[model samples]
Target: MISKIYTIIKGTGKYIPHLRVKNEDFLNNTFYDTYGKKGEKSNQEITEKFEEITTITERRHVSKDLVTSDIAFFAAEDAIISSKIDKEKLDYIIVAHNFGDVKHDNRKSDLVPSLAARVKHKLKIQNPNCIAYDLPFGCPGWLQATIQADYYIKSGDAKQILVIGADVLSRISDPHDRDSMLYADGAGAVILEGKESDTPIGILAHTTRSDTYQFSEMLYMDTSFNPDSEHKDALFLKMNGRKLYQYALTTVPQAIQACLEKSKTPLSEIKKVLIHQANGKMDDAILKRLYALYDIKELPKDIMPMTISWLGNSSVATVPTLLDLILKDELKPHKINAGDSIVFASVGAGMNINAMVYKM
Candidate 1:
């Protein structure tokens, strides 16, 4: 008889950078519009507009001395400690990040040594048997990694795995671009262990898709922001907020529904919907649409937990960090219990959308 191996989220951890950047901090800086000319909008006007649209009051940025891998190690160590799992026992370490230790000011990235390998080294895992790699799937990267971990566990190929999502998008953000207000730096991680279970108690189902045809160009970074400079150092992140908003409203709800269908779990049984913290309003729209698909008129107030107001958008790190905070009871309005159905969803840069259904 084939024994069923379940991938259980044994513990969670997160690290938010020490530098807290509030909206008012941008008031003194001059910004440029899409054109090369200085922006006509005043600093107050820009900050107010950004806050009104995204509902982001502040975000955390990594200090100049630290990098993405540093924060990832911190979060990973915490996860290992909380999980009570031995460092030498880790079977695999998967890291989700867009830029590997890129400087916030330079937009340069180092891919020579994989970020996951660096994390493993920093944690001082003497186990040469531990496999490590990096995954770059935009903002949905972390959830996607979890789905992969589930596969490894069910296949009995691994006993324990460390999944981490860390990003320093702030370094690639263009201060002149309004989207800069929405970017931040942080890392979140979870330790998943394979355990024998008769009943289904872990990741149930998942779906990941890309809409590169219509939305790939909606969010991107390039050096073309400065028409006057051909130098490679001018790269910065930018986004078509309107296009992303519409894309999330139309596609994210359907993605969640599809994921739920695969899990064979009823909508009413879901205790919480942890979504990527890209924009507060966009997330609410996604939630409402999800409810509409279920033919439920009223959206539950606490069903979808949000941290964008404080954390901003850390790209792939948002959902995991939010999940960690909720698990630790840092977020009062949200909680997860055994026998609960939880849905995780995210949409971001690649114009990618993914969802996973997990039963606890």
Candidate 2:
């Protein structure tokens, strides 16, 4: 039999902006006044109810002077340091994001200099042989990049790859949109290294699907159109909360199950699942459905660790950042030990849903 090559998570790192935004910050907000329930209740009361539903008390946003690439650089640096690999040895750098560097004034995506190339420049990788690219797979972008890296390793085409997921939704968000409160800014990265191992450690199997024909506009922004068009209101992120929630509940669980089946790993063997921190309630519901698929009635408390309560939704950065925190023991009461089986799942724009089964 041919020698099996596996991609292992060598290290992880994250960059969270220093700025913290509390729910109360939006008190008397124009967004809530117009679209939210501020008309019927006080802002404070509305904030409380908002917190109750999403469990989001606060989130982070980059400073006015920072851009998406700047934050991504910090995260990439940390991942490189933790991996202890020479900078020149990095064979690939994949960045997953929606909007590139957003001009704070205009709120436009600046993608001329691809975000991956910017990250490579920031990392000071002088080797022209090192290839860098971007993957815009919605919130599941990071996981998707990891899956791709796994393929490269298995194909013997790459040795070490840095996959970074980041986004500055705060820049693209409309202050008048209630969804603004649901978005944040952050970056997370991981170093995937190829290693020869007999045991099945690394990405074992994955599944992904996109239903954009029907739900293409379910969670998207209004940009990427002709500037001269009459769609002047196409600048901010728009989402159908209920429809997206229903989509996640229906699709995410099935994707995870399919991945598990492909991996031939039992649900009971999964130690923890690093799911996208989209919405606290919706994520919980997705996990409940996942457990139900295996006929497990009661959901495991710590099986699904979440940081969205404080981190909000940082688009693609949620999973990797949460994974980094948990791996570092910074997120207490949740830990991943050696030989543990883990699942990573996410659902987002493109109406895309994906999941991967990994062995540690």
Against the true structure, whose lDDT is highest?
Answer: 1
* Candidate 2 C-alpha lDDT tens digits along 1-360: 455778899999999999999998998565433233335566677778878878899999999998888888899999998889897898999999999998676676799789999999988889998999999988889988988898888898999999999999998876655677899999999999998876777888989898989988888665422333333555778888889998889889999999999999999899999999998998889988988988888876799999999999998999999999988999998999989999999889998888999899
Task: Give the runs in model 2 whose Cα sits over 4 Å from its true position.
Answer: 32-41, 223-234
Per-model TM values vs. the true structure: 0.96, 0.94
Q: List candidate 1 segments past 4 Å from native.
A: 1-3, 104-106, 224-232
Each prediction's Cα RMSD? 1.8, 3.2
lDDT per residue, candidate 1, 29-141, as tens digits?
Answer: 65766776777778899899889888999999998988899999999998998899888999999999998888644557887699999999999998998999999988999
The models' CA-based lDDT, in order, is 0.88, 0.87
Error of 2 at 20 (Å): 0.7
- C-alpha displacement of 127 in model 1, angstroms? 1.4
